[model samples]
Target: MNRLHPLSAVTYAIQYGFLWLWVPIVLVLALGGIFDPISPAWSPIAAPLGFLAGAAYGIAYYYRFEYGITPDTFDVASGVFARRSREIPYGRIQNVDVRQGVLQRLLGLAIVSIETAGGGNTEASLNFVSESEANRLQDQIRRRTAYVKEQRRTKQRSANEGEQQGSQRPTEPDADSSDADRTGAVSGAETDTPSDPTAVPPDRADRTDPDSTPVDGEEPDAERRAYASEPDRQRRQRLFDLQARELLLYSFTSFRPAAVAAVLFVFFLATDPIIDLLVATAQPVGGPQEIGEGTATNYGILTVVSMINGIVITYLLSVAYTFATYYDFELGRTGEDFVYERGLLQRYSGSIPVEKVQSVTVTANPLQRLIGYAGLWVETAGYGPESSGGSQSAVPLAEQSRVHRFTENLTDVETPTFRSPPTMARRRYLVRYSLVAAVIVAAVFGLAQVTALEGWYFAAVVFVAVPPAAHLKYVHIGYFVGENHLVVRSGFWQRRTTVIPYYRIQTVSTRRSIFQRRLGLASLVIDTASSRTFFWGTPTIYDVDLEDAREAHTAGRKRLQSALRERARDDDLGLTVDFT
Candidate 1:
């Protein structure tokens, strides 16, 4: 078995030692000065002792850990006090991801993660390995996985052929047959079945049968021949590379609600100090009454300035985060997998198998829409550390036209014209918004009665804006049912359009809220295997007429069944991967 690079011990030591460093600081704070006098004097030595213990553990782990690739499996063995061994078959391996942090990059090392299907975590991790070795391992695993799949296919085909031949064979001997004819038939059957089960037949020696059992002294070149036959070992085609200008624009346009909340929290915390500072700095130009009015004016101005500053700070922080997370993002495709490499501080490289893709989404916020920019996300079956709820950002920001084209190409379906919900849906939204506005205005009116609040009527502006907001919401919501895909679009602030292939649709149902039912409407929801749907809600066509909703649900189910049958036919012909 192969061992990790020698420098890995340093990385391990740093990680383990940092945990111990906190121990001494906590010990000193907790017991040194309050509980024990001698603890204070000797506490200084605890740091070095902790470091030594961490280093010892790191060295021990390094000696124990070992990993290697066998003919059909990736094996790992590692334990400090207890021994553990694991073997993962190449056929079951879903992804081989490589990541490099600042420290690891400086050390010329990288971390490799092995992920499998069903589990939403890495199955095996190689903490620190040489950069070149990491690449080699990824390539080796890919090749082996393809080889294993091909072998299984070959065996399945052979088994099927054997079954057909057995079913067609005569169960009873033909009494009318001549002795010579019976003898010839017996010889042919004996020839097909080898006397020594492990020996290859002379007639079929040149052809490699993947299902055949290996002979005692089989040549090693047979495995090499199998590897050479796999078609997946090819050059990758570049699909998308994020531009600096696009990244900058994306950062500005990206609206994170959490960032706004964080800014509000900080602003409220600093508001009192800022007001006090402003009041102290103000000069008294006249009598006490005039000075009081001037101070009040200064307080209002200060509050406005502080709010502006908070907004600016929030924007800057959001931009900085976007830069750090998505810098140097690049996407490529190799055979049936889409490969992506991204991040500035901690670089990540991984592949998304095409067969695992559940749906494609195109999103554009108001700002992005105004600038003609949009983002594309691909939802897959399992989850990854870098993915947001099973959705991977394929293109963070790009031209709307380009994003649409890419989506069409990936899913092999044309974008269809969307059908809007009935006019009653718009009326329902208007009524809903008006009711909410009325409640806010009533609340402000009550508050004004107890306090010296002026212009409580300003809160009535929400009623004035209700009509346009409701209309915008209705306009943005629509659904499309195409020949092979179902598309749903909704949201006014961030317009999201999701394209789900029919075969990938896991469920189709209709739901009606009290308000929707009152309006004689229901929502049609389409669910996929993506975990995101569970958390964020399924893609839905909201406030459709009850009859239309039922019709759509039935159509979606029929389409899903038809698409599955087509996919199965294609799989039988070896045209697509059978993820199942």
Candidate 2:
């Protein structure tokens, strides 16, 4: 078993040190003036003891951990107290990702994470390995996975051929047969022979085509060698590269609501401490006295300024984060894999296997739509680096037409002509928005009566905007049933158009809420093996007529079944055999 680089010990020491440091501090605080009256005195020694404990644990862990790559699997053994060992088969590996942070880059170290289908997390992680070792491991695992899959296919094909030949063999003639039976059988065989003079014999048919026939002593994989000899530029197609201007636009448009929430949370947590510090610093040298109205006014002004500052800081941080994560993003396709490299601080390089891709999504927020820009995402099984809902951004920012073209090429489907939901659905949305507006207005009116709230009538503006908002929602909600894929589009704020191929679909369901039922509408939900769809919500044709929803569900199920059957038939006949 190979050990990680020696520098890994320092990384482990830092992690374990922090953890151990917390343990003693917490224990000292909890036990003070309780079980031991002198426990408070132990706080002074806690720091030194914590450091010693952390160092010992870190060293032990480094000594216990071991990992190695085998012919069939990647083996890992770890644990200081309890031994644990795992072997991940090469055939089951979905992705081998390599990442390097700022410190790792300075130290020439990297982290390798291996993911498998349905794992929902990295199956095995090798942390703090040398950069060169990380690259070797990734390439070796990829080659091994391909070799294993090819071997399995070859074995299955050979077994199938043997079974077919055995079934085709004629049964021996009965010993009781008369002489006339033997003579007839011989004549029948002679008649079965081809009579056309130009017909090629069965045994020599393959030899007729030079490309199909191998030269004497030639290798079986000569074609693969020729392919490998091709230039790198010809081997991979560049799909999209994030430009500086586009990246800036994407940073602004990709604002997350969570950032606002985080800012508010931090404000609340720090408000009391900040006020206390200010009060202490502002107190007169003579003595403390009641804060006057002027002082209170100054405090309020400061509070407002702080809030504004927090908002601005949060926005800047969000932009900085986007830049750091996608500074030099590039996406390309090599054979059956989509290779991507990104990151400004911590670089990442990985590939998404084409076979694992479940769907393609084109998304554009209202701002992006106004600017005619959109983003593309490819959803696949399992987890990936920098992925949201198991989706990796293929094109973070691009023109709408470019995004559409890329989506079409990836999915092998044309831009679908979407069918709008029935008019009843629009009426339903209008009623829903009107009710929401009424509720807000009523709440504002009640508050105005109980408190000195100014501009209470401003709440009425919601009612004025309700109609247009409802209309936009209705216009954006649509679905298309293409020949090979189901496309669903929805959301007014961040419109997303998802293309799910029938072959990747796992289940079809119809849901009808009480309101939907009252409106005589239902939703058709299409599920896939992709974890993204499960966590983020399935692709659904929402608020359609009940009959239409049922028809869509049935059609989706039928197409899924037919596609699966065709795939199985191809596999059985070896028509979809993969040599790489």
Candidate 3:
């Protein structure tokens, strides 16, 4: 068992005191005038008292929390009032994340966040540990997990081999059998031939062991065996990396400029009353100018200044966020694991188990697509949709060619050929967007009627832009059913291609809404172990021909079944009896 760095207490105390400081403000607001007489004076002393209490709690926390790493499990003992102990097996660990902020780095400490296949929350977090110790513990757990899996596989093989040998051995007749039983049913002289011990049972010779049954319509053999050779960790290869300049370029390609501009505009609008108050109070050296009513020049100057300020602020903020999030991004590979390190202020280092990766997605915004670059994401099981933020970027940005090359090596499969949906999908998209435009127009008309702003009717022009938007969407939406995986490509602005292996699929569904049915079309939705695309994310191919949807569903379901059968076969190999 190990305790956290002593400095962790300081970290805890600061956090606790900062949180406690909020109590005084809340109390003052909630009590209103009840304690008005003493509140002002006591407010000055509240923070120090809170700090003392926080220090006591921090010390108590230090004593209560303890962690231990055994051969197969990582144990954490915690809880102040009621003791709670948790033990996570090494094999369940999905990723081990090491994080070090500037302060932690200066103090030679790190935070180890262990994520498992269970879900979003970190299974166990060891805060404020020596950086070297964190790395060593992560490595130790990895080695132990691999050893345990290998041991299980070896036992499975031995059991299988024993069954094979037992099945092949000829059964011997009972040694103490009567002379009549010892004699062959056919001829007594032939049965007397040396009293063979390896004689096949006359009745049971035809029976075969159910445990040694064939899989995939074939018997197990060496050629059919799936043998994976572990890689040499000493030679971890650099698979991909993003330079500062490239990262900056990727940031510029973000599709939020309009949204940011709108937000800044709204923010300025909200602060107008405060700005007016400040302007009225401030006495200027030069007297106020005599501005006439409906003067465009004066308002234009103010607007221009505000726009410039907003642009500068938004640009600076965007740059800061980009650099902090993805500075010095690098991806490395060792055996069946991927190592990623990035971030400027709080550096993040983590390892991803390749086997746990459910799918790989290649995405490109319009600007990136024009420049022939795209971003890559790896989705793992139990990672919910874009909302839950479970997916991780494999690479922030790379040329399309490089992305495909890396993806091929990662999945051991070629880039799947994509097929566009039926041409009629163009009409469906046009109808969908046009309907949305009509709704907006109707709302604008109603608002104009209420506000008497008849000019709002011009907003109906929004419909004019819908046709091209619909066309672009139709052009981009496509799907591909590969030999062992399904690929869905969609989105005109941020083009994304999601590749899902059949083994990861949990279900296949084809749905037809009222509009789709009227158009003789249906959507094919493939659900996987990861819920990453279940909601707002594009998880289905929409407006495809009904027949096409059915075909895709059938093909996907068949492939899923085949993959499941393969997994079942593997599980059978691991079903050996264990003797401690």
Error of 3 at 208 (Å): 47
lDDT of 1: 0.75
Comparison by TM-score, 1 against 3, better one: 1
RMSD values for the candidates in order, in angstroms, are 7.9, 10.1, 13.2
Q: Per-residue lDDT for 316-349 in model 2, tens only?
A: 8788788888889988765446777889999997
What is the clash count of model 3?
2
lDDT of each: 0.75, 0.75, 0.68
Ranked by TM-score from best down, the candidates are 2, 1, 3
- The positional error of residue 490 in candidate 3, measured at the CA in angstroms, is 1.0
Off-target runs (Cα >4 Å) in candidate 1 are 21-41, 150-234, 256-299, 442-452, 533-536, 572-580
Best by TM-score: 2
- Best lDDT among the predictions, by candidate number: 1
- In terms of lDDT, model 3 sits at 0.68
Q: Write model 3 residue lDDT over 305-331, tens digit each, in one string.
A: 556656766776676666677889887
Per-residue accuracy of model 1 over 136-242 as CA lDDT, tens digit each: 67766765665555555456555665566778956776789988999997677544521322122333332332223455556545643553454232465677899
